[model samples]
Target: MVKSVPAWLRILSVVFVALTALILLAPLIVVVGVSVSESQFIAFPPNGLSLRWYSQVLSSNAYLGAGWISIQIALMVTGFATLIGGAAAIAIHRRQLPFSDVLATVFLSPLVLPTIIYAIGMLMFWSSAFGPVSPVTLALSHTIIALPYVVRTTLAVLAESNPYLEEAARTMGANRLQRLWFVVVPQCIPGLAAGAFFAFNISFDEAVLSLFLRGPTLTTLPVQIYGQLEFSPDPSVAAVSTIMIALTIVLIFVIDRMLGLTKFASA
Candidate 1:
């Protein structure tokens, strides 16, 4: 029989778990609390509760426009990131590409570099050559950041799949494209879906690159929120933030349903 922990140790374990949970969840709790507050100014322990702010946000033209732009940019980033990253992962897994390690590192270097630094480089480069930054510039920058997540997740799923599946498919007279499409791609469905969601989230929530590349016409939701917060924020900002939080919760549930949270954590 498996041994059980002592009661004292179990109680201590519960305390540790509670502490860790508090540390991780405190900010989210605070943000949610503020979102529901009736006051104009933000506060953790809200004076009152009301839905007026949410109604105001829903009616705001500026917020709606920015949100539309953000969604479009995020969708584009997700598509490009998933396609590029998945292809790179497949090539790396097969060892068909030379200097795979170097290539992998190059692909993932964006994760290691500071976003601000990359933003500066992109801004200066665009300014020097392209003139002014545009929606295309924002999409490219977001794609670069999102690609690493796709690559890492794809590689994780590939690592766990049967090594002989591809070989077996080939032996059964499956052409290269047929084997890859039928056998390989199915196994990567969970990872690819997770990465696609990640790409969307990162691009939607991103601020640094957005700020650097922003024009009057190219402002994203995050950039718009940041602008308001830097001066003075109203309850509408809280409403917008609450919407983002809700979207994130929906995404988390979808990811958990498609692939266990542990699968994503491991990736």
Candidate 2:
């Protein structure tokens, strides 16, 4: 039988949890605080609560253009990452390939590699091979980085699934496509959904690759925010950050309600 925790240990755990939450949430609190401040410049412990900065962000053409570009690239990255990573994970899990382990390692290598290193290397390579960086380049680069998350999450779900499901389907005379579509794909839905959200979030918030690949007309929202911070600081930056945080939270909430991310996470 599991023993109950002592009072002292429980109190200590509560305190530790509170401290960890504070540490993790402090920056977001400051950003939200600054976002609503009436002050022209960014300041936490806001002078007065206002939504003028948000209005400014909405009205600004530069912000809108950057936001649109970010959305487009993020969507493209999510689609590519989900499709390719999900298929790769399934193949790796089946061990049908000659070098399944090596293939898995190759697919996941980007996760361990330094983003700055990859960004620089990719930028140089693209410049030489393709001449000019485009939104397509950014989408592909983001897909490469985001692919590992999809592969990892999908693999986790598949690992927990019944190994005999495919064989059972085959015994029932289910064709290859029928087995995959009716059995395997259904099992992978939760993991694929979670990974898709992760991919979208990463691509939308990605700054390193965007910074390296940005052209005159191809700035993403993160790159624009960086430029603003470097040249001129304002509460508008905080407003943009708060909006991004809100959108991400909403997206996660929606997905969790639909697919129950707890299943993917538990796996």
Candidate 3:
């Protein structure tokens, strides 16, 4: 039998959860409030209510271009990262290749390494090999950084699955391709979906790599926000940020519906 918590301890736990939630959500609330403010400057309490800042954001050519670029890069990153990372995870889990442990570590090294270091190295390497930074460069860099998350999530789910399924399929006359397609791929779906969401979110919000690879021609949404904050920031910036936050929330909801958030947590 399990012992129940004391009332005082339960009350303290509730208070702690409430405090944590408030701390995490306060900035988001302020951003949404400022986005709707009529004030020329960003303010927490907001000075009156208006949607003109959002209208200005929608009307700005620079913002529109940056948003489109961000969307494209994020989609590309999600596709490449999910494919490459998921495949690598399966290979590593099967231990089919030499130095599987080392390969896994190498694949995940980007997660432990400082992103700024990778950004600088990427910038120099690209400048020497290619000529200037472009959308392709941004997409490739984002894929590299996002790959680790996909690999990790996929590995986690694979670890918890029945290890004998692949062998059982083989004994039942299923070829390699058939086993992978019908058995392994189905097991990896939840992890892949979670990782794809993570990849999309990271690419959409990435700044360091985008900043280092930035050119006169290339600008992503986060880079645009940074430029605005550096030069002239106003309520319009808050409006754009609010919209991005909303997009993130929607993605979270979709991920939850697709696989259930608890699946990820348990994985």
If scored against the real structure, what TM-score would every candidate get? Answer: 0.91, 0.92, 0.92
lDDT of 2 by residue, 147-173 (tens): 999999899889989989999999999
What's the lDDT for candidate 1?
Answer: 0.91
Tens digit per residue, CA lDDT, model 1, 62-146:
8999999999999999999999988888888777778989988998999999999999999999999999988999999999999
lDDT of each: 0.91, 0.93, 0.94
TM-score of candidate 1 on Cα atoms, chains taken together = 0.91
lDDT sort, best first: 3, 2, 1
What C-alpha lDDT, on a 0 to 100 scale, does residue 33 get in candidate 3? 95
Pairs with steric clashes in candidate 3: none
Residue ranges of candidate 3 with Cα displaced over 4 Å: 1-13
Query: What lDDT is reached at residue 93 by model 3?
Result: 88
Choose 1 or 3, whichever is better by TM-score.
3
Cα RMSD (Å) per model?
Answer: 2.2, 2.2, 2.1
Model 1: colliding residue pairs: none
Question: How displaced is residue 16 in candidate 1, in Å?
Answer: 4.0
Model 3 lDDT tens row, 1-267: 888998999999999999999999999999899999998888879999999999999999999999999999999999999999999999998887999999999999999999999999999999999989899999999999999999999998898899899889999999989999999999999889889999999999999999999988799999999999999999999999999999999998998898788766666
